[model samples]
Target chain A: MRYVLIGAGPAGVVAAETLRKADPGGDILLLGDEPEPPYSRMALPYFLVGTIDEAGTYLRKSETHYDDLGITFRHARAVRIDPAGKTVALEGGESVAYDRLMIATGSRTQRPPIPGIDLPGVHPCWTLADSREIVRRAAPDSRVVLMGAGFIGCIVLESLIKRGVKPTVVEMADRMVPRMMNAAAGGLIKKWCATKGIEVLTSTKVTAIEDTGEARDPLRVLLDRGAPLRAALVVVATGVRPNIAFLEGSGIETDFGIRVDSHLKSSVDDVYAAGDVAQGPDFMGGWSVHAIQPTAVEHGRIAALNMADGNASYQGSLAMNVLDTAGLVSSSFGQWQGVESGESVERMDEARFRYTRLEFDGERLVGAICLGRTDQIGMLRGLIQSRVRLGDWKARLMEDPQRISEAYVASTHK
Target chain B: MLKSLHIDPGKCTLCMQCEMACSYENEGLFNPAKSRIKVFDFHDRFVPYTCTQCAEAWCMSACPVDAISVDHATGAKVVSDDLCVGCKVCTIACPFGTVNYNHDTGKVIKCDLCGGQPACAEACPTGAIAYVDSDWTGYDKMRRWAGKTDSGAAQAHA
Candidate 1:
């Protein structure tokens, strides 16, 4: 059987490798939108920081790795797919047939509707192409105006700040990283950026970017309620939406993304979805598109297994985010926002900027977050993932949550 | 069957407890500079990394003196100091940078995982570093996600 996989990102790469392992004789074709080799989007920031060259961004080092695996790699944008015909239509009007298909198209940055947003000075920090442009323009002392202080924005903030470019971040949200962190954690991040000489403007809006002067003059980024900020470059990192627009008319189910079942198979037979583009059921009961690398890799593996090995099932995905904003480390895990009537315990050292908040539904920890104090992160995940009953130790945890090791031991033994 | 040290970077807090425990146990000191299991502080992420005891074992392959060998029971690539030439060939060959030269000992060293009971895992306050079955480190995560697909809220939502 020939397996055709789209989007050569983390999920696609893993899926291709997995198919080779499961069925060596089967033909595999991996398609990517870009001209470069199958590189990792996660390593783009490292490339931006000059820690490693563009070669370091590749998911696999050896040039012949794919050739050795007997996996065919093609650089083509899949414009449409025909589930009925069991084929994928590429941009050049070429089509390929397959017995099994995997959609791992991943995601693209959502461009905000604003005037002058498409000017030469503006860019989004997403693909390797964007990184290349950013590296060219965002030199030292190159006044950069970053839009969106969410997870992606904060990450870009670090790379921009490292290049000695004092960036003025503008976010509509009341705090930085509103989705990944709580108000307190967000406040801590803003303060940390301030200490590091980066200006963070929460509850702020960028009205328009106007270029009236000569080529050398910086663009004037007009704000709603403040003076226009002069910026050499404007980075749009507002948010990301899955690349499922092409899946229309394909008869594949899609809600937030391409919906897949317990086995990572889509509603359409012989077709599967994984990565950011695939919206699979959540371990917490609904469905979500967890675009994180680890989750996507797992999705690819499981999808390939079921497509080939036949009895593999997908449980669900856990929502997890780990961030290192500048120097202050922060992390959040499943249901961290807390459920109704869930008992919670927190320890805050305002002076040290250290905090821990644990959410418990009866004896089970539903979610937790940590800022500065990063202890028992894995144990917390273990407890929540396994839904281990804390038993009487729940009361002890309520008294003091620092004894998570003790809690892990006690709960696991029971 | 050998056991494995599972590393979940998402759970690391940059506490450096793993480094301290590793140094104390292996080097008889509390210096982080001497620890074998290095925690990469990427600023935005703190990922504690060490030798993965690769199935293809590059360090062992590059060992000119046949000093590097795999422990059959644990799957960890161990170095015999007496046989090592201290040429730093393994250090250069390791793709993950887990292998390092101990200038004081005139030999290269990496995490032996403390003879299967990793002190780094024990000292980790956050369960980011765990020792589990070598064959399946993702079993816990899989089981957890599976549990969520079971009764109650899952069925209700379905």
Candidate 2:
């Protein structure tokens, strides 16, 4: 059986590797749209920080890694996929047949509706090309404007700062990293960023980016709540949406992202979707596209196993966000928004930037958010994911949430 | 020059992000018990424990089947999981107590620095954990020693 994997990002690369290992005799074809070798997008920050070169971002270091595994790597974008015939048509009218199809096309950066967004000085910090463009313009003391202060934006913020650019970050949210962090946690992050010399404008939006008509530095950005800022380069890290446009009317179901079942199989036969593009089940018992790398890896592994062996099933994915903004770390784990009637407890030290908010439903921890309290993150994640009852320890946790490690040890020791 | 994970107990906030990242990289799952890097919390401070990739290299000397070998690129002692016999000899031989056995894989596992780019160091938000030149671990300990000796301007002015 020939297995065709699309979009050679983390999901596709892992899928191809998993498939090759699972079925050595099967024909495996991995297609990537980019010209570069299959690299980890997660390592893009490391690349921008000069710790590693562009080649270091590659998933496999050896040039002949794919060839040695007998997995064919092709550089092509899938324009259309016909699940009925299991044929994928490429951009140049080329078609490839496969017995099993893995859709791991990943995501694309979202472009907000703002005037002058298509200008030369403006770009998205998503791909290697964008990183190169950013490094070129974001020289030391260069005025860089980042449009969003969300998750991806904060990640890029570190790289931009490390590159010695004093970036003016503009976010529409009331606080930074709103999606991953709560109001208080997000506010603390914003304060930390301001302390680190980054000009953060919360509750602000970029209305337009006008050209200064200069060749060297030519961008003047207009904001909703602030003064017009001069910019050498404006990075629009607004957000990302899955690449599911091609699957429209292709008989596959899509809700924000391509819909896949527990087995990572699409609605149609033998066709599967994984990674950012797949709307798989959430650990909370719903469905959503988790664009995180860990989830994508799990999706790829399980999806590959299911396709090759058809005995594996996914237990759903938990929404886990671990972020570092200029050295202040914060994380959110599973249903952090809290369940109704759940007992919530918080310990905040705004002065020290240390905080922890635990949400417990009856006897089990449904969610948790910790700012400056990162060491307890692993235990909190285990507690939430395992859905283990806090039992008599629940009272102690309610009394002092900082005793999470004790609780974890006590409950699991037996 | 080779580098090692220099962990400052005081700098750690006990996030355990390093542990999760290490476990995921080595075990393909986010299981902390499976994690090579263990973060011990003593309430007053947090200490992150992991393989030192030791200069003396006791684990290397203890390995009988030669499963534990140094990765030439990273100067890390990476265990060849395929060749390991699960004897647990290195686990006892290592003075630092970093190397341990993995019951799931029936092989010993430890931090291999992720083949030079350690996920633990990369995942660490604070400078609590750093992959610095082994020769320079003393540099952080005596941070301003050279500056004091050279000019003595900042401290000598008093």
Interface-residue RMSD per candidate? Answer: 13.7, 22.1
lDDT by residue (tens digit), candidate 2, A28-80? 99999999999767667767888667886776667998999999999999999
TM-score of candidate 1 on Cα atoms, chains taken together = 0.78
lDDT of candidate 2 over B1-158, digit per residue (tens): 87777877768898999999898887798988888887876567677766666543546544434466788888889887755544454553443446766555546777799988888888989878898888766324222322211111122123
* TM-score of each candidate's B chain against the true B chain: 0.84, 0.83
Candidate 2 chain A worst ten-residue window by lDDT: A373-382
- Which run of 10 residues does model 1 chain A get worst, by summed lDDT? A373-382
* Local accuracy by lDDT, each model: 0.78, 0.78
Residue A326 local lDDT, model 2: 80
Q: For candidate 1, give the lDDT of residue A216.
A: 46
Q: Please give the distance, in angstroms, between residue A41's alpha carbon in candidate 1 and its true position after superposition.
A: 1.2
lDDT over C-alpha atoms for residue B17 of model 2? 91
